[model samples]
Target: MSRLRVGLLANPTAAQGTAHRIGRQVDHLLRLAGISVVDLSGPSAAVARARAEDIRDSLTALVVVGGDGTVSLGAEIVAGSPVRLGVVPVGSGNDFARSLGLAVNDPESSTRALLHALSRPVVSVDAIEITAAGHSGPGHRSLALGNLNLGFDALVNARANRARSGHTVRYTTAVLRELRAFTPLPFWMEIDGGDRIELDATVLTLCNTGMFGRGMRMVPDARIDDGVLELATVSGIGRRQLLRLFPRVFAGTHTSLSAVDIRPVEQLTIGLRHGRMLRAYADGEPRELLPLTARVLPGAVRLLAEPSGSMTADPKDSQ
Candidate 1:
């Protein structure tokens, strides 16, 4: 077997108090496993990405030691490259890590599992390619290995980003605050080259993985390697109904409601009819404003993971 050398990238802002501590543990573990660990972490995303690019050639795999945003940053660099990606879930909303069957709640176990996975073959997974409607610059395009969210949830994320406390508590507080002032806005969606369908919606999500917002099963049927994207929309519901349905997302039972629609597509174009410059979030990081096109890039990246049960399994169900 070839010698293992990994580039360790971490986002210190991910889980706050525990990220750095867990990162140290991961670094030590990888070294103990006889793998060369290169520190690619930086004070910011831009600096981290620069560091990753600088050492991409020497790495057998790039191990991400933060949350979904940290994974997204690593994905941007290693997506089409030969380097495979591994994740240790150290973020508050470790949705992508959960999709890969990594232990989300326990960093020590997750790091151990990741090390085991590194000793095996890699698996290819899908990623979403997002581009701004009128921007053709290099930075205008990006990749997401998880979900892209807009509308109500994005508003909550914006608020949560500004807060300085616990992730779950901050997110919950943001939800309540936004729910008190937010309203459904009109949006036009075009799917797989289909005609435009306009509607008023409170939540719009394009998913490659099944979960977002820590553990919300927004698209329960989504699979990262399925070579397709899942589109989910919630409309025709008042704030009261939406609040009631919100918790159901954790169980993925909200899709059974009449006001929600879920479908699979290969590409999507979304624009806001109200001319609101709503922000879009992918992998828990902010992206450009509205009028975006997202498409599935099948088997775009190789992920280091052990074989596990299907992603369609219920979250409440035992693994």
Candidate 2:
């Protein structure tokens, strides 16, 4: 067997320090599986990411022990490299971990699932490469492994992230807070090198792994390895109607609604028409403001996940 060194990177305070609590268990499990552990836990995300990249040449795998934001760190470091990305799922929304059929909020079981994934074939997944034209210098380019949120949903994700509460509760609270002042924004978008069209979008997200806000299937048919990304938009609806549609998102039945537009895009450029301020967030982390371009990179991530039965399991996954 080849020697394995798995860098265990985690957020100590995610889910109220549950990530650190679970980190110990995950570290123990990896050691038992004959893998050497490199603890990469840091007080902040920027420190953790910097450390992971500094030693990326030595690690065989970088396993993130938190939610999607933590996964974002791992994906940024190991994407297209020999290192594989693993998820342990202890954050507010374990969306990526749930995508792999792992049990959320259960550390030991999820760790065991990680071990199982290590022994399996590498699962190559697509990722989004987002460029923020508004920013200059080295930080302008980034990777979004799950989904990118724009318009109203981006506001909700940013709001929910600030609260110190459970996943569903914070998301619900954020939705209510944002709804009180919600209005459609004028967004201009171009797909596949085509002409730009103006859109009055309330919620716009470009999906790779899809689900966000814990279990909301913002794009039901999106597959991470399908060589494409999903541009899901919600528009032309009142606050009451949007609220009614929110519940359906969890079940992925909102695609049936006329207000929802789902487009399979390989490349797209987006910006505000009137130059208003609108931020785009990827993997639930703030990426950049408007004037953004994104494209799908098929097989960009070598994910440590099971090979089958872990994606789009809902019967209503289709529109």
Task: State each model's C-alpha RMSD to the native.
Answer: 4.4, 4.6
Look at candidate 1 and give me any clashing residue pairs.
none
lDDT of candidate 2 over 1-319, digit per residue (tens)? 3387889998987778878878988898888878889898889988988888888889877988887888887888898887888888888777877665678888788777777777676777888888876454447778878888988999998898888777788889999999998889899988999998999989998988678888888877678888898899998999999899988999999998899999899988899987699888887789878888888988777877666553322222111
Off by over 4 Å in 1: 310-319
Q: Write the per-residue lDDT of candidate 1 for residues 118-228, one digit (tens) a residue.
A: 656567788989898766645778989999997798889989988887888988889899999788988898889899988889998898896888889998877887789
TM, every model: 0.92, 0.92
TM-score of 1: 0.92
* Model 2 error, position 212 (Å): 0.8
lDDT (C-alpha) at residue 25 in model 2? 83
Q: TM-score of model 2 relative to the true fold?
A: 0.92
Ten-residue stretch with the least lDDT total in model 1: 310-319
